[model samples]
Target: MKQRAITGLFFIIVMIGSNLLGSYVFSVFYLLLSLFCLLEFYKLVKQGGMQPERFTGALAGVTLFFFFAANCYFPAYKYIILLPILLSFIPIGELYKKSEAPFTNIGFTYLGLLMAVVPFMFFHAMAFTRGDGVFNFHVPLGFLIMLWSNDTGAYLVGSKFGRNKLFERHSPKKSWEGFIGGILICAFAAYILSNFYTEYNRFDWIIMSLIISNFGTMGDLVESMFKRSLNVKDSGGILPGHGGLLDRFDGLLMAAPIVYAYLYLISN
Candidate 1:
C-alpha cells in the first residue's frame, strides 16, 4: 500500500508537471510514453506464443506518433509520407523472418498500433485543438484529473459498498456500485475543473466526465480481458504497484479518443 501510494503520487506529479511545462515537453513526454506502452504491448503479444515484428512495429508506432505530433506542431511540413513508408517495413521484414504465423504477427503488430499508439495520438492532438494553433493544457489536465478521480472514487467506494459485480467474466472485482461511484466522482471532478479551466463550460465538462467514466470503465474491462486472454496478471513491472504502462493508462486508452471527439465537436 505504501509503495502504491508513492508511485501514484509520482505518476500524478510527472503527468501534471509535463502538462504545465508546455507543448514541447508534453509532446516529447507523451511520445516517449506512447513508445514505451507500444513496446510493452508487443512484449505481451510475444508472451502469448506469437512473434510480432517488435522493432519494425515500434518504429512504425513512433513514426505514426511523430506524424501526428508534427502535424500538430509544424503543420506546414509534410511528415505524413514517412509513416506509410516505415509501416511498409513491417510486412517486408516479416517475409524475411519466415515465421509460421506471419499474418497473425502482422495482425498483432498493427493491433499494437491501433490499441496503443492511436489513442495517444488522439490525446496528443488534443493539446493543440484550438483554431489559433495554440497548445492549451486545460483539456488534457482536466482529463487526467477526472480520470484519476473516477479511478480513486471507484476504488474507495466500491471496496466498501460494492456488492453486485459489473463484469464478472472479465473483471470480477468491478461492481456496478463502483461504476456509479466513478461516474458521480468523475462528474464532481469535472465540475471542479470547470471552475479552474473556463475554456469549456460546466455542462461540457460534465459531458466529458461522463464520456471518460463510462468509456474509461470499458477500457479497464478491455485491458482486463486482454490480460486474462494472455494468462498474465499485470502488463509489466515498470511501476512499483501500477503493474505497467498499459495498466496505468488503460482508462485513457479508450477514453482519450472519445473525449477528443467530444471536445472537437463542441469546439467546432
Candidate 2:
C-alpha cells in the first residue's frame, strides 16, 4: 500500500509537470511512454505463445506518434505517408523469419499499434489543437483529471455500494453502481474544469467527461480481459505496485481516440 501510494503520487506529479512544461516536453515524454507501453504489450503477448515483431512494431508505433504529431504542428508534413511504409516491415520481416505462426505474430504486431499507438497519437494531437497553436494543457490535463476521478470514485463507491457484478467473467470486482458513480463524479469534475479552462463550456466538458468515463471503463475491462487471456495478474512490474504502463494507461488507450473524435465533433 505504501508503494502504491508513493508510485501514484510520483506519477501524478510527473504528469502535471509534463503538462506544464509545454508541448515538446509533453510530446517527447509521452512518446517515450508510448514506446514503453508498446514494448510492454509485446512482452505480455509473448507470454501468450506469440512472437510479435517487437522492434518493428515499437518503431512503427513511435513513428506513427511522431507522424501525427508532426502533422499536427506542421500541417504540411506529407511524410506522414511513410508510417504505413514503415509498418510494412512487420509482415515483411515476419516472412523472412522461420516461425510456425507467422501470421499470429503479425496480428499481434498490428494489435499493438491499435491498442497503444494510435490512441497515443490522438492524445498528442489533442495537446496541440487548442486554436491558438500554443500548447493547451486543458484537453490532455482534463482527460487525466476525468480518468483519475472516475477511477477514484468507482473504487470508493463500489467498495461501499457494489452488489451486482458488472462483468463477473472478466472483472468480478467491477459493479454497475461503481460505473454510474464514476460517471457522476467525472461529470462533476468536468463542471469544475469548465470554470478554469473556459475554452469549452460546462456542458461540453461534462459531455467530454462522460465519454471518458464510459470508454475509460471499457478500456480497463478490455485490458483485464487481455490479461485473463494471457493468464497474467498484472501487465508488468515496471511501476512497482501499479503493475505496468499498459495497466496504468489502459483507460487512455480506448478513451483517447474516441474522445478525440467526440471533441472534434463538438468543436466542428
- Top candidate by lDDT: 1
TM-score of each: 0.97, 0.97
In candidate 2, residue 244 scores what lDDT? 89
| Model 2 agreement with the true structure over 21-67: per-residue lDDT tens digits | 97889889888988988999999999999999999998899888887
lDDT of every model, 2 decimals: 0.91, 0.88
Backbone clash count, each prediction separately: 0, 0
lDDT of 1 by residue, 7-84 (tens): 988989999999999889999999999999999999999999889999999889988888788777667356587778
**Clash pairs, model 1 backbone:** none
lDDT of 1: 0.91
Ten residues in sequence with the least summed lDDT for candidate 1: 73-82
